[model samples]
Target: MFRRQFLGLGAAVLAFGLSLCGTAGADPLPDLKGRTIVAVTENAYFPLNFTDPKTGEGIGWEYDAMNEIARRLDAKVEWKTSSWDAMIQAVQAGQFDIGMDGISITDERKKQVDFSDPYMVSEQFMLVRANENRFTDAKSFAADPKLFVGAQAGTTNYFVSVSDLLGGDDKSPRLRLFETFGASVQALKVGDVDTVLMDKAGAEGNIAASPDRFKIIGNGLGHDEFGFILKKGSDLLAPVDAALAAMKADGTLKALDKKWFYDYRAAH
Candidate 1:
């Protein structure tokens, strides 16, 4: 399970306001008229994009949002799966028409693929076992060299572990790299690592799924914005952005957030 604390009070306030606000309008845009799009995701990130443990069905906020986007754009989406490490390059190579698995927008990544407008903004937090009490925050965790952090390589979590959570050294041995966020969390569950860094949305989903097993520690590290990825100069970018803008303007985006982030948690 996961827990969350905002990076700052102001951010928390803004998040709350955004959640309750209705969309301003639904402007018309270029429509694909039933063109097919292949979208890929690593079915590992809980609440964003993951296979249901019981049903083995892919489901999450990203799935819901993408479905709505395809509907609005008059497109058909064929879902695909890829490892997180290979997703970017695969998208860049034109193996997939689009990709999304809570990918953060960053300059380094932008060099490889174009990103749609920001869809969601969140902050990173420390995810730890429920009974954890050794150290409360990043500083204390870093002080004890024995305390290890689990993270997936080339992710926001790994970068945060090296730069903010661990010391500014990427080679720090105290950090354990895993192939997926689920694997890192599994390591934490089995006492292989002291903590795993995850965004607030992810943490909440994990915690909701396994409330007794995990908890979040300290305030969040910093802000991050998630977006969809496409091949460089892909013509699909504009229509996709238009769909997203339309969703935001019509309150569909906020409604989805509430359905997945709040209502889904309660139901689960």
Candidate 2:
């Protein structure tokens, strides 16, 4: 029920500005001549790219955004799924034309793949079982000897848990690693771990889905900018960026954000 406000223009003002930029009728987008682009994702990150339980089909913000981009660019997309750990490297090896997993844009990651302009900015938040009251924030959670966090290794969540909450000791016993965010969340649900660090948007979605089972505690921990990954030197980079810019300018991106982050309900 608690939605975090962003540090930018409000939705109505942004939409009005976008409409002015696009004029009334003329299409200014580039045509890709029906080239097929391969897109991959983990499909586990809630409200970004994940399987819909009711439909057994992929759906989320990224899916909608990418599809619209392809439409505007006069291209087609072939979607694929990848494990979270292998996504960047796989894209770097030219296995996929692009990858999306709410991946943060960081200097360390830039070495492997080129990133598009950020689609969304987010922050880390603590997710814990609703009945727990042992600690209200990270500091108190760290002070307790019996508390530990569940996270997927090689993720922003894991790194934040290590650096911000566990004294930068990645090998600390207080950190339990899982193969997927779903696994870590399962661990949290069963009391296997005291908490899980998640992006604020995701935490909000999960909490809204299961209010009695989960709750977010403490202030947001860190800022992150999410972008789509492209192989270095890929020809598709510029076109994808252009399409994204158009989407932003036309308010399509803003509409997708509202649909996924604030309006849609996932079947838990």
Best by lDDT: 2
lDDT of 1: 0.84
Q: Write the per-residue lDDT of candidate 2 for residues 38-102, one digit (tens) a residue.
A: 99999899889888776778888898889878977889999999999999999999999999999
How far out, in Å, is residue 80 in model 1? 0.4
lDDT of 1 by residue, 8-126 (tens): 44335335534533334435667797899999999888777888766877887788789878876878999999999999999999999999988989999999999999999978899
Deviation of model 2 at 3, angstroms: 16
User: Model 1 misses residue 216 by how many Å?
Assistant: 0.9
lDDT of each: 0.84, 0.85
C-alpha lDDT (0 to 100) for residue 231 of candidate 2: 96
- Each model's TM-score, in the order given? 0.90, 0.90
